[model samples]
Target: MNTTFGGKPHVLILGGGSVGLTTASELRKTLGTEVAITIVDPRPYMTYAPFLPEVGAGSIDPRNVLAPLRKILPGTKVVTGGVSAIRSADNTVVVTTEDGAQLEIAYDYLVVGLGAVPRLLPIPGLAENAIGFKQVEEAITVRDKILANLAEAASTKDPKVRKRLLTFTYIGGGFAGGEAVTEAEDMVRDALRYYPDLHASDIRFVLIDAAPFVFPELTEDQRAYVLNQLRERGIEVKLETFLNSAENGVIKTSDGDEFETDLLVWNAGVKPNPILMDEESSDLPVVTERGPLMGKLDTLADLRVNGAEGPIDNVFAGGDCAAVPDLASGEGKFCPPNAQHATRQGKRIADNVARSVQGRPLVDYYHKNLGVMATLGMYKGVGRLMLGDKEIDVRGLPAWAMARAYHVYAMPTLGRKAAVLAGWASNLVSRRDIIGIPQSADPRAAFELAANSGPKKK
Candidate 1:
């Protein structure tokens, strides 16, 4: 470790997600002005991921889910780029900036919270057509795309074409997929109320999952309740089913069913950041087929990366990128890759890093997961709550309220929290905005093209 720091003991964090920002916040508190902290991420803000479903549903404004890193982490030097490589051999990181420039940063301490990317399968047409359940842009694009379908449906006369435009398919039964389908269903239903031609029955929401149950995290009762709740609203719940192919706007399932649709949400799961497995990050010896591993950087209980001889001396990692052992769980169990675990782990790792720098004994991280919840759109939801020594299942409005309240509390800054609350409050009185705005995706195509062409120069 760099003992002599003229207030510049560089601490480089590889992500800007929940874990990355939390680590920066805690490190500031623990290290004070002793070390220089820098965080590099592809995005300028830390997305409040739990609100992604609401964003897609148009229940929350897109900006509400984004907490600007500059505004949130004041003392930290935030780099708008992705870490292309993490070479632990000499404590150096290669960052590919947003402008396509490469910058190498030498760090005395490293925190690899690179986070996860969507797990996409080799399903036909999925790569070219389907939208992901991650990222703010994905949520926005989904909202626009679904609305665009409605616009097309509203203007069409042919039954088949209308049906094709209105048909929606979601592949995956996890929280992302569950929440997305439900929210989209809700949004489209709301939209149909205002459309003169499109009837409620015209829109078909199909949720297909390979698993028997939609949410594996939910209790049997909760799962049954959600399934029934969705079906009651005309949403099709097809379990033990797989999407065989989604090619050329034709969606074919393994159940010998085929349909044409413009929308398909792929939210199967996520693998750890591919950067860990890339040639740039090869020197760390901290990667596996598992993507993220605790022993990769060979981290000790105190968060210091352990090498063959002893502590690698400076590098530390957590979040979805590390396999930190879950001290609260039973023997040989690692923390689950979730916001709850990652947030706590990030803070713990940060504090330990500060202590390690100060030549003090480091402490191990331990935190029992308080609960897990998934919103089912509007006043419906499901969750497992941990109270005292007992764990209880909640559903319906109560579950919805609990989930919203927790997410609001956890949403980064007070400004963002207030913005989200305001959006929700407004939603209660006014109907959802159903205008199709796919141009938001490109944002500048029209303007750029117009500018390129001489503007009334005659």
Candidate 2:
């Protein structure tokens, strides 16, 4: 390995998300001062994505879902920047810091965990109007938007305006969309108790998906059960449907359904970071085929980048950005880009990197998925746990409990876990807080207006 400074191998990680955070933590713990570690990301904090649904529903505080990178990884260097280009041939990466300063950092080893972004379509007004649900801020916006709409609908005497404000349309029915729509619906239901003028029937939730069913990960019976539960809550489940246009608050669907919605959430899917596919930005070998796993870094089971013949030297990648082979499922199968795989792959890659530094044989990553779980509102959920070769299906309260337990265990720090648990416990005894700080979206607006106001003459 090339040593750039202090005669120690400098490991540069290109993301501060699940994989990056785990890898950095483990490397610091295992290698100590033997290696110099640096993590570069646009955000200084790592957002725990699984609890985003609860955060959107006001069940969890947004702060509880974020762990600061600097505080968590004390010994490692944290750079708040976005990578513009990866010049692996020169052993340097070009990064643009938050303040727009460019830097070229040299590293002996490179770890790619840049993760994915929303796979948006070219539908009309989609980019301008649709809200995303990927990060903690987006989750907070979703919560605030829903609450703000409800409050506005309650005061509006115009029936058409009220109907439009109360209608919330969600596109895509995957795990993220399914949980998000359901949880948002629950919040509206709970908040209706406070508004005597608004009833449950006044609010409308429409979930649209291009597929025939939502939660394809669930079994046939389980999927049916989820659909039934959602319909029972008065949420219109429109499967085999697509959003044709979302122009000017009017939603036009492929099924010829037209409606006006105040809020539109796009959670269809995600693609690997654009830098991985762009030739100018990255020279890495990425799968460019037109498929579900397209535009991902071609990686091996040992978490090393795939070269023309074999693994590349000192270049490792895992997480949503890499097409890692699913060794446990045999050949021709790749691991799904999910948090469950990303977190485990992080630990594996860290150990393998340490082994490479010590001149030891590296180990392959293989782990059977433990289960699939989704929460529907507070105490309702669905889960499928893998017990050996058999599958155990669970729903309702037990599944909800299991989902919470799993997330608490999966969350990075004990402090964050305790905070999340405290929020959930408090909600059990008190009513859900329906107050929306819409001003948070533009916190400086009021101050800016005051500053522009002309001084009054005495």
Quick one: best lDDT, which candidate? 2
Clashes of 1: 4
Model 1: residue 13 alpha-carbon error in angstroms: 0.7
On a 0 to 100 scale, what is the lDDT of residue 282 in model 2? Answer: 92
TM-score of 2: 0.98
Local distance difference test, each candidate = 0.83, 0.93
The residue pairs found clashing in candidate 1 are 286-296, 293-323, 294-323, 298-306
Clashes of each: 4, 0
The residue pairs that clash in candidate 2, if any, are none
Q: Model 2, 248-357: lDDT tens per residue?
A: 98999999989999899999999999998899999888997899889999998999999767788789999999999998888999999889999999999999999999
Least accurate stretch of 10 residues (summed lDDT) in model 2? 1-10
